[model samples]
Target: MKKIRAALLGATGAVGQRYINMLDRHPFITLEVLMGGESAGKKYGQAVHWLFPDAIPERFAEAQVRTARPESAEGCDVVFSALPSEVASEIEQDFAKAGFTLVSEASSHRMDPDVPLMIPEINPGHLELLEAQKKARGWKGAIATTPNCTVTGLAIVMTPLLDNFAAEKAIVTTMQALSGAGYPGVPSLAITENVIPYIKNEEEKVAKEAKKILGAVKGGAIVPHELPIGISCNRVPVIDGHTETLYAEFPKAVKPDQVARVLERFSGLPQKLRLPTAPERPIIVRRENDRPQPRLDRMSGSVPGMSVVVGRVRNGIDERSLQLTLLSHNTIRGAAGTAILTAELMQKEGYIG
Candidate 1:
């Protein structure tokens, strides 16, 4: 098998390093370059100060770390972008226009009509827009983004119900992990034992991105649903997963067991393609009362290295809603893992050669 040559745009950052560990053993991917900003030209061993100790590969030591230049990643089959949002717009756009497939973890172009905000299990069909993106921009490649960490879990649980019971209104309050803010994020003083009530742009992301992911595809464009999505976001002291408290109004009644079975068996596009990084079961529901705790379920055996774990499901009567708590590895499932899964799906669908 010919391995796909790949490059990592922010190879030294937290999520970028996860991309390194994942692609290192990926049977279909070959890491060709490790790019960074100020850290460019540093040894990979030194560039990444903290890692799994065993996850960093010896082969990466010789890989040159350079600031992203169009010509640097010119020949790669795909580029996994972990660049900070501040600089991602220009860098990612240039790569896409230069004919390199760009799978990103940034919100820069997520709302762009041409760019697909995808969660493979819920909306794999959204990949169809990649063609339109490429042609509309006269580029050789395209871009795709994962929903915000909080949005990933919300959409996973809501998808089945929308199809079955028809979700009408979604009210979500998220306790997000500090890591969601990125490296050297949130000061220890501010979060050691605190729960700050603000995460700029997060609430809006959950509201809008959720609708887009659940929206129907029509005439080669995404038509977002008019469902009411009310979201509240907060930054917590946890290191890994972001947990959400949700109250979803359903158009019809649903049994608790019915909802449980749906989540247990839920598998969509990524599952069918068997994408290398795709989680076998997109939504894993825990029967135990306190099962999907951050430290415990964030990186469970089922989706090792993938982000997300959901639990605490219950049905409501008068409210006509279902309530649950959701947890996902903010950087993994919510960012890098999803990007890798997207790349693998693109590879399987022949979007990448």
Candidate 2:
């Protein structure tokens, strides 16, 4: 099988760096173009500030960065976008109109009714929306997005619970990592000693996007989950993982052991197809009381950073409520890795072949 030629848009930010790392040795996709804004005319190595622990790959180090224009990406089979939401809305559509499939990490299109806000294991069915999107927009290609990073962990954990126990309401409080803010993020003086309790528009994104991700696709449209979700987002000093505490009210009583059993055995389309980036266990249940901490569990999974580590599953204040803490690598499973996995599913389903 020939490798698909791909382009990386917004190739000089935190999320963009993750895309570069994951695509460096990807089995099915080749990084053929690098695009950026101010960094457009420089070599990738010179343009990027280089935040990741791993050294930038030599193959891409000397590749010239180009402006993110459709013509610059003409021959690529797919475009992996990490552009800011404000800029991505227009540029991603331009690429789609110019006949390129876009697997994006931008928040701009996550709520669009026609675009698929996908979690391969949780909502592979939503990809069907792409057909409607292409038809409605009159484009040869389409956009598929992963939800906001904060929403990713929340939605993944909620999926199994909703399937086996059925949720009536959910409340998630998050301690998101500093890297989520992007490069030159929150001044050290502000974040080093204290936790900032708000992220502009984060809480709303988590609440709304979760419903869409866990929603059902019907009659050429997605029917969002009716379950009510409330969220509070905070920015912590940690560098990589996002930790969330979930409290849910299920319709009926469910024991901790039952919830653990369902989460431990959960697997979806990515696992069945054995996509390279998919973790063997999407959710790793920890029996210890002090587990799932960002320092220790952020890298949990066979594919490191691909799994969500869950702990402290117990009854809440009442028999109908359950509480637990979950941790996920914000940049990997929450952003770039999920986008890559979505593209893999597209290939398997004949949407991108």
Candidate 3:
């Protein structure tokens, strides 16, 4: 099989660095172009702050960073965007208009009626919306987005429960990591010893995006699931993982054991198709009371940082309610990693060649 040529936009940010690490020796995609804002003319190594503990990949060390314009991505088949939402909105569309499949981490297009805000394991069917998106926008290529870092874990955990027990309402409270705020994020003075109770628009994104991700595709549009999701987001002192506590109400009575069994047995399109980046198990159920901690379980799957760690499953406020805690690597499973998985899914579904 010929490798798909890909480009990375915002190549100097935290999420962009992860994209670089992930694509270093990717099985199906090759990193051919590196684009950034102010770092456009410098070598990638010189421009990037290099956040990861691992050294920069030699392949991209000397690569010249180009400006984040569609024309700079001329030879790419796919464009993986880590660009900020403010700038990504226009630039991503430009790439799609130029006929490049775009998998974006920015929030710009996640809720667009035609765009598919995807978690491959939970909503592969939603990819069909890409067709409607292209036709509506008159673009040759289409845009697909991964949800906010906080929503990714919540949606993935809720998927199996929703399927097995018809969960209709959810209340999620998140203790998100500092990384989710991006590089040089949250001032040291504010988040050093305290928990900032608010993140601009994060609560809204989780509430709306989850329903859309869990929604059905019909008549060329996505009808968001009728389920009610309420969320409370907070920025914590942790460095890498986002931890969420979820309370869900099911239509019928459910036992904690039953919920665990369903989650343990759950697998979706990505798992069935054996996509290269798919985790062997999308959710890992832990029985210990204090499990799923950010430091211990954030990277808990066969594919590290690809699985959501779920623990402390128990009865909620009533017999019809179920509650559990989940942890996921925000930058990996939530942003860059999920974007890569979406691209792999697009390739498998023949949306990208």
Candidate 4:
């Protein structure tokens, strides 16, 4: 693996900090440039309201944050964006036009017919759209995106069920961590002792993004899966993992034990290639009745926080439906980790150098 110069956008935000934390000492990818808005011209360590208790890496701690623009990323091989949706749209596209391949953690481009909403483990093939994206958009570079944090764990769990048992519908309810709302998230007064049952546009993003992730690529475009997905999202007091309960309907009766086996055995292209950020098992199945709890299981995996932990597998309303609880670290498996993994796959497949 050649050393890959990397640039980060929104470098002072919550997910952006995760990118820095995870990339320190990375074997190949180096955090070459940090880009941001208000933080621009300031040192990264001083600008960021660091979330992780571990100290910021010394080198990045002293690195100057640059203005969010393509020129600031002058020599990077790939860009990792943690920018918010409202402003990320234009800024990211500007980077794409300037010829920098990017893997974004924003909602703006995920649904673009040409932009792949990626989950490396679920749809590595969708990256094939990049070439088409360049041609259609008339840009020197292209962009790939990771789905919303809530959708990340849900989509990964749905893949095996849909493939192995022909699951046709999914009903999901998510108890999302506070970190998911971004830095300086939900005021303590509003969320400390309460569960906010609504997160604007979250349920919609989950359903739509999950389908695209579980979809197939054909004729240079993704043919979104027609699976019916119903989701309800809530912001919980928990600070990191997003926990989701999934009830899936299948054409044929499938036993809980059988479902567990398939999920436990699930692996994808990244695992096959042993990508640095890919977990040994993309999904970890727990047999204990009260397992997959956020604090204990959210980070469970060969690569900590990269696997989806699933438990409470059981028969649903009927034998043809199955229910289970799943959890993943919102900042790791659901944000920076997946984006970094996608970049690894892109580099390995000759999309980025």
Number of backbone collisions per candidate: 2, 0, 0, 0
TM-score of each candidate structure, all chains considered together: 0.95, 0.98, 0.98, 0.99
Q: What is the C-alpha lDDT profile of model 3 across 1-353, one tens digit per residue?
A: 56799999999998999899888989889999999999999999999999988899987989999988889999888899999999999999889988888999998998889999999998898999988898999999999999999999999988888888999899989999999989999999999999999999899888899889999998888899988888899999999999999999988899999899888888888899898899999999999999989999988888789999999999998889999999999999999889899999888888887
Maximum-lDDT candidate: 4
Clashing pairs in 2: none
Winner by TM-score between candidate 4 and candidate 1: 4
- How close to the true structure is residue 236 of candidate 4, measured as C-alpha lDDT? 93
lDDT of 3 at 135: 90
Q: Where does candidate 1 stray beyond 4 Å?
A: 53-55, 305-307, 317-319
Give me the overall lDDT of model 1: 0.81
Give candidate 4's error at residue 181 in angstroms: 0.4
Which portions of model 4 show Cα errors greater than 4 Å? none
Model 2 misplaced regions, further than 4 Å = none
What 10-residue stretch in candidate 1 is worst by lDDT?
A: 301-310
Report how far off residue 350 is in candidate 2 (Å): 1.2
- Error (Å) of candidate 4 at residue 70 is 1.0
* Superior by lDDT: candidate 1 or candidate 4: 4
